[model samples]
Target chain A: MATGSFATSGADLELVGIQKRFPGFTAIEHLDLVIPAGSFFALLGPSGCGKTTTLRLVAGLEDPTRGSILIGGEDVTHRKPFQRPVNTVFQSYALFPHMTVLENVAFGLRRRKMAKPLELAQEALELVELEHLASRKPTQLSGGQQQRVALARAVVNRPALLLLDEPLGALDLKLRRQMQLELKSIQEEVGLTFLHVTHDQEEAMTMADTVAVMNKGRIEQLGAPEDLYELPHTAFVANFLGQSNLFTGPVLEATSHAIAVEVAGTRVLVPKARARKHSGEVTVGIRPEKLRLLTEAPPTTAGVNTLGPGTVTDVSFSGVSTQYQVDVPGADSVTVFAQNLDFGPVVTPGTEVWVSWKVDHGFGLEDSASEEAKFAPELDTATIAVQAKRDLAAELEVS
Target chain B: MAFAAFATGTAKEQAPRRKSRIALLLLLPGILYMMLFFLVPLVSLVMTSLQAPVEFGDIGEYETAFRWENYVVAISTYGEHILRSFGYALMATIFALLFSYPLAYFIGVKARPWPLLQKLMLVMVIAPFFISFLLRTLAWKSLLSDEGFLVSSLKALSLMAPDAHFTGTGAAVVFGLTYNFIPFMTLPLYANLERLDTRLVEAGGDLYARPATTFFKVTVPLSMPGIVSGVLLTFIPAAGDYINASPQFLGGPSTAMIGNVIESNFLVTNNYPAAASLSIILMAVILVMVVVYIKRSGTEDLL
Candidate 1:
């Protein structure tokens, strides 16, 4: 709904027609974003996807080759970094190595001419719960401690906006998860617009209100984390945000409410709203967790569920969930994640099963063949087998 | 499994032994070099420094004896020169650091984007090293001569006292030392500043630090290791330099340094004991100064 109206008046950060080009590569191009006041926003993308570049443009560390950066409705494109009412938590934490923790936090406040800089710095450290280590230098602190200091350093300034450039990337997984919650609580308490840049989809989904998935110098999709996870517009977003099983083929039928896409021998019914383009030769997608596995074939009832017979190629029990790889002959291998309710027959490799999911759960996708090519190779061998199976199934089903 | 564990244990034990063997192999040439050039000469110098002149013998004649008075005599006779040499060296170190820091900063940090300019500036810093240090000091002598173009022009512009000369002055000697050791100061500084994490500076700016504040608080403090090393590199050599302060170069008899005094005792006067004692004193003094400087450099805990 934030995209519904062009409300520039209260937008904490606005980047219009932002483009950054280095000597040989365009880091960002035609990027336009408006982050509303007090909203937590994240730019989620892989490396070289211009998410970091956009963050830098907003941070005033880089000049946009072609556009205006307006912060709090003020045109700050020509302003220096220090002149802007914004700050950043760098990926490396970039704490002043020479200064003590208290001194580091006090740095920005002192520059801003606070009346009681040390008192305010102590308050900031207490916010991150690191007041006890105030006298220690940055190198003396642990990775997690340094991260808290970095967060304290930026949040202490109380800028109109704060940019976190993968601030938790240096921590271990457990510490990262803990910091994620801590950062969210801090962001909520401060009520400042947080512009976080991260490649972690889970982190973005867990903390950010809005996530803009970037790829190859462009915003592929931008929406609420739930909306993006549920209704991804591009193949890149669907695959990058989480695991996705894509079925690209000709459209068999199209209606206002729904589009039936024929993939291999099975026809997938996706709501028209989910489809980026409801036309001929489109790609249909579904999430791994959305797919259901059944030992017996369900009734071939229309609108009930779409079904495909396949052999269980892999079964992994991950305590809470059991992930299955089902290979349909002449079709791609499909991934199905089922909760471990401990209520069904144990599915193992080489077992016969039917892959089924409701029609409404399937989503539509646009041209993702290129995006698929770039990130698809990083998928494990089972996923590749699924793709290979799809190719064979396409030829077999059509004939 | 038990046998494999035993093999792993033996492999672990052998690994350090192999490493030590390689270390010994690597250290053999260095040990040999130090023994032949440094340790042997050091022992001979100690013997010579302790030797006394033969009673009622010729001025140059001396014999090995426990005459610790050679050190006392050396200190009393050349104490002024010793202090003057260190003072001039300290001045040159400070001047070289001031000159090289900005040059290194501009080239290594600012001109990094322009590859051609970086190469050109680096070449300019190192080009002097390709020429002999003595020849360069001699060139400076000619340049600062009373009738030379630089001095004559300065005289015409009234920048210098009309009758004041630079060729034999202490200022000229210190200036010569600074110029000769500038690359020593610049290269180490450039090496450290070049790898500077620019993000810290940007972080400072993002934290609302003004440009000047960022430079002093973040950039300069982070470059301290470079400054300390550069000062050490320049000071150590400048203190021991002889030719730059010799009368044939830029110095006068009144402006003689410890190096010039030691050179005269060894080659001109054949006073071996005096030369040896003065050399040892200069080494001891420079070592103390270097250690004290390092302690106060604020980079003690850092690598």
Candidate 2:
């Protein structure tokens, strides 16, 4: 994609230690972010994670409890949204219902006391490809048409920054996918800094050059999409960004480049470059795709790395891939995805399987004693009860 | 199989017939009521407007004669009163609009938890209806009198020099009309503005428009339908009201409206022909103005 070269107007937006608290609840805590003159940034999170609050703070819609917001290296923390050179496209588009498409697009221009508001509005409408619908009212147009009208209405003023708060949330899936590409292209062509907010990981991965994953009102991690996916630092990031299987065990041997951990009286080796801390017990993390399943049990256990023998409890056949649940001894059940190859019969329930993975593919983290303190005393009794319940439910469902 | 298919087709065909019969049955009472009450009275009023006056003493005068010139004589003779009626109505509408807009905007947009305020406003609007219109106008007269509480308060505040009076003037008539018609303007405006999308204003603010500009460009245009309705509501009734223009209230010959003139012609002067002609002319004028207003504003379908 050919994007217009954005001039270095000197790092247009900066947020320094912004904090927002509502009554007893804190929505954003000590948040620091900086965007260059032109950068496509995404704030990704689950619900109630304060991505929207950060955007609102940047746009000057909400005043921060602490810290300052600077635009073009000038403090604008107390300035109103209208005083700032930023515009927002809300999730609902929020086009004026009473006005024609042309009037809606011309609203900001007219408010600014421009001499030729109609001409400017026409040019904007042309930019969004809504010129033919200029005379039609908002309700007379389709959803996508209304969206374009909203876009034109904002971009007509040529603001310094554009904030899009889940603008494609209301569209159908196909329309959403189409608009994602369109929005990126438009942002590129116009050379405007876009700060987008979304909960969809795929949307952030596809559009944002840099992604910030937020959890519990704080940014857990911020990096490029592939970097965050390949090397997640925190347990929340590893779990939230994508799926990963975690194993808890004690480190029996440690070295500069590798560590051997003992799980259920069996030794497992993990690469040390990915390990965070390595003295005592540590948690090992591996992605589901890294594990391999074999039909026959291995003859010898030497040099096999980590091996688990269990029966296939359940199998799910997706169109292009298949997922199998294997119940291992003294370890949590693991989910493994396998390609649906035509060379063999499909794996089904009640089939014996061996799950094994290499040592270099796994990473370790320090074990927090808090988790053990919370669950250790009652684990022995609860595990048997949970297993019995699962068995009964499965039998009842089959019957 | 063939018999079953034929039976299904027959059943589908008969379903619509049965539904049509039920629909006709449901419509019968309304049609009958319209014929008996509305259509019959309108036809009779038009017919009576064309007939000669019923004379009490002369048999020759009792003979029926179609006299359309009575309309012209009635209008010309009471032209000032007709014009005063329209003038008062226009003034009342303008005043109501000016007073009602801020009140409606405050109640609709600024007041959170709006259902309680809406109920309170509904109570206040209906409170006037509970009291008789004649009594209310008389109350206004007393309140505006020279020795009344309002005048005394103004005198105490040094705003009035003890010689000022508000009663028996066009100002009093306009005040009374406004007091009665204000709710008619506010309720519709409140209803329309309340239903307006708040997101539109937020969007405007986000697009670098100040609050004042947003109110003018977005809020006002969106609520024009309610404004037009409120204007018509205040203007039409104010034009046809005679109680507000009665002499004992605040009106004289100069302030007498068309309704007063029509009432006098019918009751005091016993000129039925003139009264009927005046009624026809007033109705025609109101109809034409309403049609033109609807056409010009492009809000005919709002009603």
Candidate 3:
């Protein structure tokens, strides 16, 4: 909700009406952003959603087709990459193979003709806890070490802005988790603007002070991580940030306090402000973890819990939590998550159950399922993000 | 349990040994070919270089002996030719590098957005090689004749005296070497630069290196494998090339390279020991120079 109220005195990175078209494809369109100085900002989106393009534009590697790029209130749209006060830690960790780790970290300072390049480079290496590997070439280091060296290389410059394009994407799951905390601490220690672009929602949530979910060359949603997760403005954000069970319905009353909507023949009340669309039709959404499942049907109370009559279709136990899919006639399957604090009568697949959640937890969304159908053929978009995350876990098996 | 662990560990170690044995078997042909054609010839040449020439015998005959004086005699007799060969080869290698870097960079990097243009330019670079270089050098001989269009144009421009010609000059031979070996230089350079991680260069620039500084500090050093190979490909052969400096071709007596000296000693003069000694000397000098050059360039892993 608070968009432009962080770190007012320091240099803020601003993008105004930026558009970039590559030949026949438009990578970015009418994009606007304000990354407050000294705050960690993340651009989270699937591949080909313009997140990387936006990062490149900020890094001065790619000039926007139209609109301006301002770093620290200075227009650097026309400047070359070196002239801009920005640095990028590329996804591949692109540590210069030919240079020693120390030389790689010292390169930026040496280019700036700063004195005591070695000392500053050593300090930067120590920040990443990789000072001992200074004499080794980049190829000698493991993937995680290379990643930290790249981080040190970019952060050593002390640029007004540091751009990281999937900085931990190549590391193992355990290393990535460790680096996420390390990176957050490093950002805090440096007190400089860090713009991280990643497709992993957890990474964004774990590190960024603000997360902007980008899709289809535009900003789909931008807010604090919890806000975006709990009250997504669109079905895409609902599905992307985490799993959401969508129930399509017609809006019956757009009251000031709550918007009444009929879902699966059951009347549901959503917080009025949460109803992004006040029109006739809206998609009702609830997180699986927020829903409660009961074996016996309960009487529905107005302005309270909304209950849907259904039969449990599937029950899957995953150690910490048990998930259930309930088949409600005339509606999609409703999913509910139950934490295993205590065991009771197990809900079997053929048993009748009631899926209920609080009124405030249910929110209305502007129809994004139609957009999903239109862009559904790009299903690998989902698999790619999932695969990249899964690949980290798989890499741990190798080590 | 520990015995089983040791057994499995030893089995795992032996598996790679078997794999490497297969790898060595796969390399057998190459190793045999090198030993047969290259190693044998090299050893024979070194022995012949040390053989004493016919003493109070037939003019062209020689006997096998440990005549360490052959090297001294060969160096003293063909010192100018030896130095000239290396100088010309060095100049040609430098020219090839200077000219090929830009051309290769253009074809491989600049023209990357246009696949058709890249393939076309590569073909054009290679098209000249289809015609024999001997014929091309011969064509150049005519083109640089006193009355040829090139010579006439040069005369008109006053860049050359009207009576002067390019056919037999040392410049002509060096030019010939550069022209003949340009493709060798360009292709490898193109291959290396084509696969160059543009991201690394971008990273260098992002780290605040200017474009030119990046070219020297990053681009040039990264492209070193190509440079080392290209220089070796051009310089090694150019140092021992007879065709470029033969009197009938691009050069006269003053431009005689070690190859020409060897050819004359073997074919015209029929002094086989002198010819063999010169060839051995040329090979030894080139090997030393290449090792020193590769070391100086600071990339021993390239070799």
Candidate 4:
């Protein structure tokens, strides 16, 4: 693992039954996750979903109320943040404003009494393509430059697990996309475990090998990004990952290969492997892009699930694709994303349309009603959001 | 039509000029106040410093003559007291900083969550200001006197010699100065520390710095502006303070500072020129010292 001069592989990070509780609410509850050595892992969630708390717990910035954390099989649950072999690229970059870029990057190495701190810091800066800015103070740099400096600062330490708490959340859109790719390549080159926490789903999907979608202090689903997006286990994951056309209904028949679910008087078949619940009431869901908006009724194909006789309520043309919101009978709304192939007629609002998708594309959630109820009110209140982002108030409560 | 166009162009050009004139007019009160209270007194003091004693006149009489030798005489005659004032002020500034940094840090950073406690602490620091400055110095004088409980306790504890007393010592005066001007030291430090970003300290700990290293490397460097301003606020006023260094207060004849010397010259001996010369010397020395200190501290942007 340590063959080259600056090459040090990561250690396995294990969180065993971790739980974090604030004064009035639980931030994380019963989280047991393991990222294999040298893998890029991401904890994906909305605000206040305990992703940041999980990162802090692993970084030793916050202690779990009822669990242990182990890195490479050694317990670090009670260790100070500095004692453990972990570093964080904080959300705000938190670069020492008084220090030059070189000094800030060299801080950890110097503190650890490491050899050739300046040279190593320069190397890290070069990795981020910021060697020319080594002498500038953090405040002097642009947001993108400061972000790279923060990355260099954390990566230079070569810690066992580098925790990134929304490290690129402050960047503009173009810079954010560029940093995402650069962060992925750097993680691969360093071969260290990068535990990234972010609320941006696209960022998480693009940068991580395994993404865990968290909701209300629990992992809603954990899998490869494609798997999580394709077959979500919970309604929260299905909605959060991307727009979903969901239909809540009771299972009409449970067969070996698939389950027939009745949604608004129409039957839809979800693959048995994709159905989180097979014999009871379930919520069937499909990605917006997976459904097709048909001007006429779809053919009575053997393997297609269709919901029709709806009016197109809204149509949005987004350069590469066209999104249609269809108000179907007995169904609130069904969204469909059609590629701008330019071969079909332009469908305007108030046009009759049918939303259809292949049966195998449907995924079913077991606990549909309660999860949907919890997701709706989260967006309306301001207090809930403030409470969610107040995870850094540990010291205030502890004292 | 051409004449009308020319008149409009001139009016347009005069608009900004008239606005600037209004700006100057708005500044008239402040400028007049400075001239009346500051510039006039400064000019009068300079004139008095150069005045020579009138021949065969009263003790307070002097005639206008450029006696530059007054400065030379002030320095040569009262050099010890001048040095003693600065020395005591320097010690008091250091003591105030040492005492207030922790208190300010605790109030600004540690007690941040309990806002009520922070406010209470600030109130306690400024509580001395409610009473008159002279009263506070007089109170300290009595507290440190030979028969006072504090001196008696120290004597009984063997921390002080049995024959020793505190009423007239240099330490007593410095203590009085530090105690009196502590709020000056604390308020600026607290203001700066209050605006400090605590995430930087957390970053220090995340980067392998222990608590003490984090404090020295991060917190202290970040609080330099506060420290510099606090030092200035305490040192400048404390250097010229007389009540704490007077025989009527905490100090005695041997512990006389430049302020006590100036007081005696002005009121007792009626030496107006000498007192004015000494005041000018004190101001010049403080200005030079402050400039050098600010330059060395590298917080010139604060000014």
Encode model 2's per-residue lDDT on A1-399: one tens digit a residue.
001222232236788999999888999988898877667889887767888999889877788999999887889898887777787877788988878899888877776666688888998898767899999998998887788788778777666788888777656778677778877876777677888898777789899988998876888789999888876666656666666667778889987778887775667778888787786877777777777888787665533565567778988877677878987777768778877676433677888887777776776654432342432222222344476689999999999
Clashing pairs in 4: none
DockQ score for model 2, please? 0.39
Collision count for each candidate, in order: 6, 0, 0, 0
Give the per-residue lDDT of model 3 (tens digit) for A1-399: 011112223258999999999999999988999999999999998788899999999988998999999988889899999888787999988888889999999998888877788999999999888999999999999888999999889887777688999998768998788778878887787687899999888899989999999987999899999999989988788888888888777888877788877777877888888878876878888999998887777776665665567888899998889989999886778888899879733788988888778888888887655555554324334677667678989999889
| Runs with alpha carbons beyond 4 Å of true place in candidate 1 | A1-11, A113-119, A129-132, A265-267, A300-302, A328-331, A344-353, A368-371, A374-399, B1-57, B61-79, B111-120, B155-162, B265-280, B300-303
lDDT of 4 by residue, B65-91 (tens): 999999999999999999999999999
Best by lDDT: 4
- The positional error of residue B169 in candidate 3, measured at the CA in angstroms, is 1.7
Residues A1-399, candidate 1, lDDT per residue (tens digit)?
Answer: 121111222238988988899999899879888899889999998777888888888888999899999987889999999888788999889999989999999998888777788988899899788999999999999888999999989887777788999888778888788778877886777677899998878888999999998888999899999899898888778888887888877889998898887776777788887788788788878888988888888878766455567899988888888889988764588888898787533788988888777788888887754457875345433454477789999999999
Off by over 4 Å in 4: A1-7, A342-346, A376-399, B1-19
For the predicted complex of model 3, DockQ is: 0.47
lDDT of 4 by residue, A219-300 (tens): 9889999999998887778777876778888889988999998887998898998888888788889999998888898788
* Fnat of candidate 3: 0.85
Cα deviation at A168, candidate 3, in Å, is 1.8
Please identify which of the two predictions, 1 or 2, would achieve the higher lDDT against the true structure.
1
TM-scores of all predicted structures: 0.84, 0.84, 0.90, 0.91
TM-score (0 to 1) for chain B of model 3: 0.89
Candidate that would win on TM-score: 4
